[model samples]
Target: MGFSPDSFYIKTLGLTNTDDAEIWEYATTNDFVIVSKDSDFHQRSLLYGHPPKFIYLRVGNCSTSKIVQVLQDEIDIISQFGDREAESILVLS
Candidate 1:
């Protein structure tokens, strides 16, 4: 997906490096979803809640082309997941 610098809290906050908790705080405050391969965010979502939903990619290391294709194919599902009230995390494999 195309991301503008403004779309990332890290960039907006002028942060070069930050911890997960900080990132979580930024996302929650800004109502931005967290998309990552790290399971940390997934675990955090389960413990806390969703204002900042999480999208976890379960697929193993792959080419960028393949990743893009998978995302493109699942765009509909992703969009629907974002709208789910009770769901905090969406795992895409």
Candidate 2:
């Protein structure tokens, strides 16, 4: 299944410039997965555990379409990750 950008992306939420801590809290409260390249989210997930699971991308800077393609390639794994209650951090290379 394709991910919906209007419902899932930070830019769509008018939060592109928002602080990370607030973004973390918002995701936690909203039952949304946080997709980011920033290592800070990975570190935070490690420290605080779940509620808002994080997907960390190690692809460096890339086009939006490239990011989507990477995510699509891992959709199965991501779906599995969502079903497991214990997994809090998903690292995508």
Candidate 3:
């Protein structure tokens, strides 16, 4: 549903069901960084401008653990740039 900011972790919002736009809005409202495999998120970010922050993984392919670690590794770095009024995007590969 949602994740704790301390965790900087994703609470899988589900799949084959939830719409990307809804998820995007949810992330913005909840102040949760989206950790998704879909490239659509990036496209949407550009189209709608941006939220406080976003993380888009451009890795071709990888294990879930690897993806999670990538996010974990950058949590602090990204957080430093996070601001409610300042939208941002962090791309990791």
Candidates sorted by TM-score, best first: 2, 1, 3
Per-residue lDDT of candidate 1, residues 1-93 (tens digit): 343333453555675478999888888888888877778988998899887999888888986567667767888998899788999988888
Report every candidate's CA lDDT. 0.79, 0.88, 0.66
Question: Which pairs clash in model 1?
Answer: none
Minimum summed lDDT over a 10-residue window in model 1 is located at 1-10
lDDT score, residue 14, model 2? Answer: 87
Estimate, for each residue in 1-93, the C-alpha lDDT of model 3 and write its tens digit.
Answer: 122345443334443476888777777797766666688887887777667356778877887677767767776766675643565667777
Estimated TM-score for each candidate: 0.79, 0.90, 0.71
Residue 76 of model 3 has an lDDT of 77
For candidate 1, the lDDT comes to: 0.79
Off by over 4 Å in 2: 5-7
Error in Å for residue 10 of model 1: 5.3
Off by over 4 Å in 3: 1-16, 83-87
Residue by residue across 1-93, what tens digits does model 2's lDDT show?
Answer: 236643467776788889989999999998989988999999999999897999999999898788888888998998899899999999998
